[model samples]
Target: MPVRRDRLRRAGESAFGALLLTRMILMTLLALLMVTGGAWSSWDTARDALRPPQGAAGPLTLAACDRERCTGTFGPSGETVALYQRIGREPGETLEVALRPGTAEVVRTGAPGVLYACLPLAGSLLLAGIVIGGGLRMYRTAWATAGAGIALLATAFALW
Candidate 1:
């Protein structure tokens, strides 16, 4: 009787430990997914934005060019492309720009295109930091990530 009780207790202890381990693994995986998905989304958008215009560069009839950005209709696709963080050109004047592949965005030939492309990436990192910190309890790493994102955004604005 004593031996049987001992065996049962041991088995229960082992099972409890296993359960805890499983829970930890599951939570870790979820955290990783959140961070990775956020970063990937940002990277994909940035990649598309940074890529140089493909094929022949075309002209756009500027519908409006304010202090912040320029909006114009691309002649090739007849689509509106907003040029962010770029110098404003005349509202009615035609300017040459390269259309971003698979997006309704444009970049001037000599503009700082990479900085503009990275704006969304910084935002994503900031959100990911919050998720990792609040959901996963990784406070240190989360703060660091969030800080980096803020710095990037600040840099973009300053340089713009």
Candidate 2:
């Protein structure tokens, strides 16, 4: 009877120790995920601010086929432009302007678009990691404390 009781106590202690170690590992992983996500979000915001405009318009040129249609190239890069008049100045006229990019925008505002698209996914992942880690740590601490109390009671009972 004594030998069997000793074996059972040892097995319980070993299981408790394993559970505690697993909880600590989970906490560490969650902290790392939070740090990485924050760094990536900050980097994306910085890249969007420095972008420059594309396709400058120098001198406007009127089209031969239609006087209302004007085309001109602008900037040192000589970006092309095609303008269509929607509203005319005289009665029965339209006014409208359409600008198309001859070259890609400088500095790239697209970074924010990419970051925002992934933000929800990353945020959910980070939230889950934190909750799971915290919950595990709390459970481990409670279990360890309870185990210590039980061990003390067992020792007192044996001594008596």
Candidate 3:
């Protein structure tokens, strides 16, 4: 009876080990690296947005808007700046914003800025789930991470 149990344990170990091959691990690592690279590309903007805002602060008088962006004039200087990928803004509406130093760009302040800043991380987490589940065969972790990402996105939408 003991011998039979030992054999069963060995069989289980072998089956588990089959999934942990060198090639599989390497492939999984490569995929994760790619995902990391993509995330890093967006980290710059996200990092800036996440920080306490600096530079000029005042109302932006929006002049023109299309689907991708809105152009506006900022403060007393009337420096032209732009806001990208944001919604609920109408032309000619004066929204409070801050200048991104050394550039003709602006970001929202307060709750909206913080919420928008989190978007990149949310997207990266969503992508990581695919890598973890498919390449690394970690379904539980994948689901948890992806769920967290989705929840963040939903929360931002509800509150932003």
Candidate 4:
């Protein structure tokens, strides 16, 4: 009877260990997914905003804004266009912009543009940190991850 009871106790402990390992794996996968998804989604816009001006280069004259979108005119051509990202600029404000091919929108080519485009990646880092810390019990790594996100956010806001 004692032997049987001992065997049951060992089995329960092993099962608990297995469950814990499975939980850790799931959490890690979730964290990876969040980070990768954010990067994938933001890549094109962020790259366009961060790189040197290409294609059409001009001063965009903001014509009007409704809620999150602003319509403007691009360059000497006076082509009606839109700001690639939502901004707080009012009508008549002019900004240097680069026109994206196949789109009626232009991306701002400076720090402000880069920051705006990277906002999602920063958010993902923060969320990933929470999962790594609380779910995987990697406190130090989590703190580092979250710190990176905070840094990015701060830099973006400060320069914007």
User: Against the unseen true structure, what C-alpha lDDT does each candidate score?
Assistant: 0.69, 0.42, 0.74, 0.83
Tens-digit lDDT track of model 3 for 71-154: 988875687899886666688988767677778887776666666767776777788777777877889988987897798788
lDDT of 2 by residue, 19-55 (tens): 9888778766665565466556644433342232343
TM-score of each: 0.55, 0.33, 0.70, 0.86
- Candidate 3, residue 2: how far the Cα is off, in Å: 13
Off by over 4 Å in 1: 1-27, 54-69, 73-97, 102-104, 107-112
* Model 4 agreement with the true structure over 2-78: per-residue lDDT tens digits: 54558889899999999999999999999999999878877778777767345577789889987777888888668
Weakest lDDT window of 10 consecutive positions for candidate 2: 89-98
Model 1: per-residue Cα lDDT over 1-160, one tens digit each: 4545688898999999999777657766765665566567656545544554466357778888778888888887788888765444678877656776666776654333455556666776788687668766789988998998899878866654
| Model 3 lDDT on a 0 to 1 scale | 0.74
| Residue runs of model 3 more than 4 Å from their true location after superposition | 1-19, 27-35, 52-54, 86-88
Highest TM-score: give the candidate number: 4
Q: Name the better of 1 and 2 by TM-score.
A: 1
Give stretches of model 4 more than 4 Å off: 1-5, 52-54
* lDDT minimum window of 10 residues, candidate 4: 48-57
lDDT of 1 at 143: 95
Q: How do these models rank on lDDT, best leading?
A: 4, 3, 1, 2
User: Which numbered prediction scores highest in lDDT against the true structure?
Assistant: 4
Q: Could you give the C-alpha RMSD of every candidate to the true structure, in order shown?
A: 5.8, 20.8, 4.7, 2.8
Q: Please give the clash total of every predicted structure, in order.
A: 0, 7, 0, 0
- Which scores higher on lDDT, 1 or 3? 3
